[model samples]
Target: MSTIPTTAVAIEPLSISDRLSLVWRIPLLVIRCAANFASFCLSNGEIARLDWRQKLAHAYLRASRVTLTRKQQAQQRKLLTGPRIQGYCHRYNLEHRAVSVNNDTLYKKRDIPTPVLHFVKNPTTQPDGPTIFYLHGGGYHNPIKEQGHIPLALQFAAACKAKQVVFLEYSLSPEQQYPCQLIQAVAGLRYLLEQEAVQAENIVLVGDSAGGHLTASLLTHIVHPSPYAPPIDLRGRQLKAVLLVSPWMAMSEEQIKVLPRAPNDFLTRESIVRFSNMFKPGLNEVWSNRCDMHDAVAVWKKLFPTSHEHAICRKAMLAVGTSEVLLDSCVSFALECMGCETIYVNGQSDLRLVKEADFVLAIAPGEAHVQPGMDCALGYHDGKMMKAISTFLEAC
Candidate 1:
């Protein structure tokens, strides 16, 4: 498919409030990281002792260096096209080659060509270790590469003593819609189980933002598929756990407008609508768009189909920052899930701590969307989220 041209928008000056938000964020991140490291030490003495201090330090330093502004985000949107994303992935590969044990690209070989899957195994870890199937988020239109995120993958692998990390580079929207990405995900899952000979019990599914939505779809399909949609035969397999970071699981154009704005949120209501439009057919175009013939919205409804039945994984963990715009939606989704209970950590009462008897919701105060991943690696409160994810995965 031909790449769609992205129109560049002129950078706009930040409002005074936005400027002050950025100024306050730097020190806040440092303070939060320190507080979180201390909390980890207190709460998880054994895991904390396993060289997380260095990881925490690295995350803090990185958090201080990268700050996203409206202008920068606008510029970023311009660079999310096919060729630019291809180049971005190339740069990621070049940059992370030194740390990666084995980095190979593989194709899913679907009817419609899907994006390449970047599989990076931990060089130091022994083979047949646990695997994390990671999906990066870019609102479904853009994708961040594994190179950008492999450090966190490595950190998880090291801390959990896991073996491999597979980053699925699924096809984006306006080019491929709905089931294309989902199909690619099932195919990738099949590869891990069948080709790599990895046991399903040792596999963990992790995704951020739109990637989280995809992950949710994959899990729900495995657990209870929509009768209307084509089934993904899991080959009698299941995953150990799932971790969703700021998942856009049940988003609506109406909900986006009503969501409370966060100081650090790069996602805008318009962007959400625009991205949704790419894969989700509008009321007027539902019949016209071939991808929507099977009804993607129906599939989404099936995925979230009553929070009560949403616990597809044996164990699940959700992390969202209190300051993120998606906090309410994420919390609501968690609360609706079966057997979920709310718990408070660190006296952050405003933070939603929804958990099923088996699920974990790690709410980081004053953090915003997708902070624990490579893009916001070492950002404030990320240490907290990472600590939560590590603890949950280890327990599972």
Candidate 2:
């Protein structure tokens, strides 16, 4: 087993100064929204492809991208922390607990605050049932949205009948870089095993976009220990499952630009590269190269060499929309997980054979990035894809 860190990092409260700064940006935000609307109107082809709901969501995300800087978004995220977040949980009748993790062994810098593990549980949740370790995705920069992320978490908990949901509030990028978020995640997982007494086999790692990238990073660290981070020992056990939603698997700018642009998808090449650089400054191609289609099989073999050492998990599901910008990479990664030969062709094929395999690939037709979760946040349930996800998790 990995050694747990001895020190704990405290959660810093947001100051009045931080809240005051946001008031001045309201006018600018309005201007940006108007500009985004004009751009949306001009893109007739893209608009034609999207449903009414997707069109509005795409517009909102685009405006948000321009209106708020990552730092501002980070500051706004502070409002959702502590008692505020707990209050939100109360509305759903879910219990909330905050656990601060020690980062003394994880980082040498004292300024980098320790990560927080937000434990949320439904009233009907079973004590010894499955536990979800959720990692929110915002390109490793933007703060989690109360309306979007909180509801999405509740949906997952309901879907799997989870005993508890552990959301890791890891440090954001530009301020904190690679291995910092990675190590903090390891620290959070350690807390689940050592403190909470949760079995490794009952833990499910669920992450969206960049969180999905972090989830994959954790798996790699398990197979080959990172010198910078503490190692975890599963005690001859494997995780219950891994569910990645619209994962940002590829980091290469050239590779990402080469992929066919999905008009309805909100992601852009420029935004992806900018976020990737913030997460890993002076970016090297070594990490991104591992995701290449030609090397996928070899990479998966190295990560999950044997059944006993199943660092990847006992079962896996990779869900991506047919209209996602990262569709190619997501599909490739899913194929690797299934240990199948990589197929480069565009439209869906025999990938549905995943129903018979331990690794499943779910494609949401006519949807955009992280569509199901986004839809859930909008109070739209009853999606066929989401039901499939619930069925998959229950079976696992």
Best by TM-score: 2
**Which parts of model 1 are misplaced by more than 4 Å?**
1-111, 145-148, 226-230, 235-237, 281-311, 347-357, 374-382
Shift in Å, residue 389, candidate 1? 1.0
Sequence-dependent TM-score of model 1: 0.64
Per-residue C-alpha lDDT of model 2 across residues 231-282, encoded as one tens digit per residue = 8777778888888888888776666677777755778777788888878722
Error of 1 at 348 (Å): 13
RMSD values for the candidates in order, in angstroms, are 9.7, 5.9
Q: Report backbone clashes per prediction.
A: 5, 0
**Candidate whose lDDT is highest:** 2
Candidate 1 lDDT, 62-82, residue by residue in tens: 344354443434444444334
Error of 1 at 206 (Å): 0.7
Q: Could you tell me the lDDT of residue 319 within candidate 1?
A: 80
Question: In model 2, which residue pairs have backbone atoms overlapping below 3 Å?
Answer: none
**C-alpha RMSD (angstroms) for model 1:** 9.7
